[model samples]
Target: MSILANPLYRPLFEILRSARNGIVYGGKLRFSHALVINLLYKSGPLLPRMKSVFEATKDHAQVLASFAIIYKIAVHFLQSDAVLGRKNLRLTKFLAGCFGSWIVYSGHFNLFNGGITHQITLYCFSRVLLALGKILLDKYLVCFQPSFINYQGDTMLYKNLNGHQQRKLKNLIYNKSWKYFAIITWGLVMFVYDYKPQYLQSSLRHSMTYIYDVEMDTWDTWREFLGI
Candidate 1:
């Protein structure tokens, strides 16, 4: 049987679908934000690697334009449920994982600088928040309705749960909203730091500098210290 057709695998499929959608949406937003920074501020000093890419290439504008097109194509591909079969789904998941790994590696290597690091961190945290929000929304807001239970294929799924059990589930999901709020607040703080690092207090700036040493400082110093 198809994965979605099997009751045992349906929940997994739903979770994967939600996660993929969140990632694609988050990535698209990040790319668009980068495009704006590249065009308007020229990546500024905050994102040194992006500035280097623009400076080192003669056709950097064309390259960025191509990247925008590619981002749109990726978003479309990820969103299209009708065209994605099981094999395609697995392949896409593998590709997404590889892309995520590359993003982490690039941040560590200072490929884009501290701003990129901040953006990557926030993007990841936000995606997780979004996935959890989707799950909770489906369970509490969508699935709790009598109409939803009636229309669902397996009546036993909801039939086994009493009112108290359903209320408990809703309460559990509702209580997790604080996590989503925290992620959003953290993302905003990162955004401010990316735009105006000097606005941060001296101690906080020092701590952030230490934390993002690879991205915020020169790699040559680290190499010299290591005697490489």
Candidate 2:
């Protein structure tokens, strides 16, 4: 117990534990998603159906687990020797993440065509990019920070706004901003899909093509729906 609990071994313990958690979490999440999407998009022999699900599950779980292990190792390595003489917490975390991500992106964990790994990485990148943007907004564009987040500051003009006006501005920046962003995004994506669908990811392009470009003038679709 003492040896396992020793600080010297803490990093190893953390890496193992994180890897286990990542495998369980990533497998479950991808299994549910792949099952539902396959049911909607494809139907065939039981072997292929099970194979696709199992392969996707393995790829997602492996990527997550490997990333967890790599990140822990990288972070600990950085924290070990302050080779730079001065350390930044944000730098340590960001660099460690980048290290782990690069190893994964270099085709280490994924063994298939890698579309799933690419999508997963892109999803995480977009989310981290958004959160980083919000952090910057809070730091510099402090007034645009979400209403729900509280902080201290009393810049001169900030003191002049009444509660109602403050709430309104916060709503514009925090809440309605996303609503409009989505509206604009859908409009833009549809426009792009019409003219430059090749620029879209294959998954998105195929889905959009099926949804938007399929012949609606046909009674065939209606017949299928009606089981005719």
Candidate 3:
């Protein structure tokens, strides 16, 4: 049976699909059209507000990633019945994921000086709003129906498949090796862009320098920006 046919898993699958779509599409826009618009066209009354919003949400990438990972782990445990008898496991998992991600990411990659009180408050509030929105939508939306597949008795995919094959299939889908490689490659690319902004198109370099206030000609500003 297909995983999407299972009611219990369908919502989670949809959520994951939506997340992946947003990451791909939104990332492309950020690097291309959005970057150009923000740099060149964003001005007048709206520019300050836009900048403020960007600053507030600048360090939220790690927090969002942490939330996704934790949410997946929590769903896994819930589906496997690992925490069937445990009370508050869901809450604990959520808190741990949020706080742990924030602490690790902020400590290592924090670029701003002074305190992070505002950032922490904003992150927590954003999470709360997201949870509330999801709950409301799930409750009111009639489009999501239970999967026709029998998720309790047979495996999600290829019910007749052997245990080893099922495990292999699961591993193929959930393996982290490729994800790590992608992350490393992305990090290296970002490092290059930051280290040598001049390598990019002149317009983009100027825009980036303007927004980030980085002096690409010298190491002193870069070091200071990195808090080294």
Candidate 4:
């Protein structure tokens, strides 16, 4: 009955595993690594705690936390590009807003949990910020790459387009917008879910700590064995 062994966990695990594979076996390994690390910190551990806020019947916060981390990582491949498409000023402003909000939320959560030593809900806030930063970095890297966005060796704007070109432009706009909306919506859902008392538990209140302990040891072993 372990959450990690459950069928539902497979999808999340596969995504992370695939990311690891891409990092190891595919090109752009640094991109994959940056992406995975960003995801692990933000969505992995904090997801289940957010879920525990609403559903009292399910007793698997730790598992959810693990999912959150995995989910954060998987979605980044989809979301970061959207933020990068915007103007630099707008992107910077949006990220600044998110950072300020995170600081307030983190401070409040830490204080509510009793003190800095308690560190409640900080991971959730920290993940949100990390996600935003990753998007910025990804976009910056893309900008330098040139091949993805350059058209006839031009980076400037064009005022006119024919039917075929317009259709392609439309698709690009829609695709970016759809992804941006999805990421924002998902992030908002997590924020709302994390605020409820039902999800909030005293530290060490989870049903399974052994799984995390095992996973931690496994992670360390892999890190050492792989020299990663």
Model 4 TM-score, 2 decimals: 0.21
Candidate 2 residue lDDT tens string, 25-118: 9899999988887877777876798789888898888888988999988888787665422266678888888898778765764543477667
**Per-model CA lDDT versus the true structure:** 0.54, 0.75, 0.52, 0.45
Give the worst 10-residue stretch by lDDT in candidate 3. Answer: 141-150
For 17-47, candidate 4 gives per-residue lDDT tens digits of 6545533432233234334434543345656
Candidate with better TM-score, 1 vs 2? 2
Better of 1 and 4 by lDDT: 1
TM-score of 3: 0.29
Judged by whole-model lDDT over C-alpha atoms, candidate 3 comes out at 0.52
**Which ranges in model 2 have alpha carbons more than 4 Å from their true place?**
82-86, 106-113, 141-156, 159-169, 220-223, 226-228
Clashes of 4: 11
TM for every model, in the order presented, reads: 0.30, 0.79, 0.29, 0.21
lDDT of 4 at 206: 30
- In candidate 1, what are the lDDT values of residues 3-65, reduced to their tens digit? 569997765555555555544654565556555645654434656756544443323232223
Decide which is better by lDDT, 2 or 4. 2
Which window of ten consecutive residues has the lowest lDDT sum in model 1?
58-67
Model 4: residue 203 alpha-carbon error in angstroms:
28
Encode model 3's per-residue lDDT on 5-62: one tens digit a residue.
Answer: 9988876785576456544543443345444565555556766756644543443333
lDDT of 2 at 181: 60
